[model samples]
Target: MTLSAQTKVGPAGLISDLQSLGLRLEDNEVGVTGRRGGAGPSDHKAVSLAGRTVMIPIATVSACESPFVASRPDANGISEIRRNGVVVSHIEFPRQPRFYDLQTTEGIPYSQIATLHSSDVLATTLLQSCIRYGNRNTSCQFCAIGQSLSAGKTILRKTPEQLAEVAKAAVELDNVKHMVMTTGTPNLTDRGAALLCESAEAVKAVVDLPIQGQCEPPDDDIWFERMKAAGIASLGMHLEAITPEVRARIMPGKAGVVLERYMDAFDAAVAVFGRGQVSTYILAGLGDTPDVILSVSEQLITKGVYPFVVPFVPITGTPLENHPAPTPAFMAQILPQLGAMLKKANLLSHDMKAGCAKCGACSALASYEV
Candidate 1:
């Protein structure tokens, strides 16, 4: 039943290890119900697995003072545990970047636009306010993109020049290797892809770092080509949920873009960024059945898109805070299927060149398979 032996284990073993960490399996999804002591959303839960904690929704673990739990034998905020009584340690959480304290000459907060994750890559949402957030009925249920803006923690927009300045400082001072530029949907003809292109061009003006740009697919396929010409090395067009019903329920605003548009975007991006350079995020435990997710992943792979499947760890302040995280068992079942698909497609994470999936910090699926 030992799950982490550098070799894949059965789904049941993954389930057992998660249950040992106080997780529950409901409707074939693994999750837990508890409060981390926050202001809003009292019923939020932490997504823990194999004794390690993933994302705890903002409502669940919002404040820095919130009471959260770490499993025994903690390793720098991550937990470690044994399946079949063989213990394995978890990876360490990367430290917060030092560049956050610095500000641009215009007195703009640098951290407002971008922040570091997993301790190395510099990630930014150039446009903090999403038009979708204005419509309560249509916004992505799991997004807190505008919540930070409402809290006055970030700015409404960031210019390419400002982003370029920050990238320079982050690379020179923090040794950042890669950069991720994502945006809130702007009501524009290019669907925010053009803005990402501008930012990528500016950043490339300062450094030759690997850059990944994510957005809803542009209305025209040609934007993918433009993005590549602008110095963007990779592309991520996230299909958060594969099922139509799930998409409507969890991401009404984003769902309007339709799966066909995302598929088209991915295909065009694959042609521009190349196969392994194009990816999409498929969130687990969002009401999509494993069969459904697997089927969608297969189609995506056939079209040359890497399905970056992540557990649905609800964010606080969002509608899904009360929602649960997918169990290790669920991830284990899906990871092998995804791995086999990738193997057949001749796509590998190591070939991605750079990005979140390439970093392999958010989920253990990449390490478990590739």
Candidate 2:
């Protein structure tokens, strides 16, 4: 049983509670286009609960429906979210982005280059192709990078020129606050940092939005400095799983990078980006115990890197699509401890200038800290 605590049921808390529980929606295609790539499902849609917008998993593979949370439209462009059988709150879906309508002179849709995430952040995969995505032996078993590109939902490589045009339109038309550019690992030694740096340069020339570039650690540490010089305000080097065994099991190809190397890279990145600006993705419940997650998070905190611990929702079409998300009680047991650690270290997500740690829709850790 969850050891119930007397917690305040405010807006952020309610959104946090719902995202932790997952949300079942009457329609998944209404709001932002859910971008699923090498990351975990990424199938959640944005909802306005109590004035704040959050990304709640509504199109998960394992959870076709959530027991505690569900939403349906009411009259007057409003939505009612029900708990069990009672309506607990009213939520709103953001209107479709205006940038989605326009296209470049080359006839490429603006949205095909990048799209709005949550309510304000702009995000895209600079290179949708990855070296490790071809087969199970090298592939991170959960990656769907090839799925959308294979179906032609997005293009292969978004040139710097195309990205700049899209970024400018997204900012002027949609009021985008920040930009996040993540790329699949290419065969080159620079991984995708070279592409991210070029993309960041292009976007910064066109708009003044803070940008975050996500990639595996580059072959050398200097790439961090080059990336910062290119106008990327923050960096994300993800370690989707915590334990060595879980790393090998869920993502053999990614497991080759090894935790020791990631730690060294984190040290290098923090030195360049300073504290809180360097972050990593730690997908909770891909088989890591709560103890393991908290322990690793502590280590990451010590290095000045933010541990963006998010629940692992099994994406449809991936190998682990049948796997279960962490129990709400598990997240409850962990968030408080992680929150205390972050507070003590002064590594709050808001200190981050740009990217997922600041936007913070996929995870509820930011709300937990408050």
Candidate 3:
């Protein structure tokens, strides 16, 4: 149950509550369009709460049962956030980006090439298809990478030229501050690092926005230097679950790469990207306890890697669609201690050049940094 009105929960607690418990929308609150399904953080909408933009789950199964209901926006586009019919705070959704309405010189819609993440970040999937996604035995059960491609919302492959075109427009038209390019693991040793390099290089040539490249650790460490040289400002190599048992059970194909290899990769990447610039994503509520997550996060921070812990919101059509998300209390147990570790290491998310941790929309961990 949420705290009573007599309790004074600050913005951080409110953000965590909104993220973990999700939010319901009133019938008239449909002016803003929420992303239904996509590659990263699917079934969510970007909302501004207490002046901080965050990705809040709205279309998930958990949201259907949430006590937090958002009223329709007033004339000024502000909505009241009520928990159990009592007003707690206010929120505003980001307007549809101007770049989303434009088309490339060749007439392809810019949105198919790239989309807005948070309020001002441009994000794209370099390759929509992954080698393991087609096979259930090897697939990450929570992934929706193929769903967007299958529904014709995005293209299978985004060429360097197309990405550059959309990126430049996103910067000029929508004031996009940075770009994030993640790809499905291809059938190669570089594991899509090569594609990210090509795409980042192209976008940098056309626009000045910082870029973050995310992919599996390449077979060779040299790729990190190449990525930094190609104008990629930061890197993300996600270890979605820390424990081997959970990793194997949740993402069998990814677990094959092993945590030891990831440790070595983080060390090498940190050398190039510099400390806090290298980060990872650890999904909470995947059966790994907060203690285990914090233990691994400490190791990553010691290696100069930022471990971005996020609550797992089950996406539709995936194997775990009906699975429950972590409760707000669960996140409460993790973020405070993790934030203290980050503070001690001086690995502030604001110090990151460009990445998920920097944007910090999908998780409230950043709010606990204070």
Best by lDDT: 3
In candidate 3, how many Å is residue 207 off? 1.0
lDDT of 1 by residue, 231-291 (tens): 9998888898987899999998789888987887788889889988988888888999889
TM-score of 2: 0.93
Per-residue error for 148 in candidate 3, Å, reads 0.9
Best by TM-score: 3
Alpha-carbon error at 319 in model 3, in Å? 0.4
lDDT of 2 by residue, 263-299 (tens): 9999999999999999998887888999999999999
Q: Locate the minimum summed-lDDT window of 10 residues in model 1.
A: 23-32
* Candidate 1 TM-score, true structure as reference: 0.80
C-alpha positional error of residue 125 in candidate 2 after TM-score superposition, expressed in Å: 0.2
In terms of lDDT, model 1 sits at 0.67
Of 2 and 3, the candidate ahead on lDDT is 3
Summed backbone clashes in each candidate are 4, 0, 0
List where candidate 1 sits over 4 angstroms from the true fold.
1-93
Q: How far is candidate 2 from the true structure (C-alpha RMSD, Å)?
A: 3.8
TM-score of each: 0.80, 0.93, 0.97
Candidate 3 lDDT (Cα, 0 to 1)? 0.90
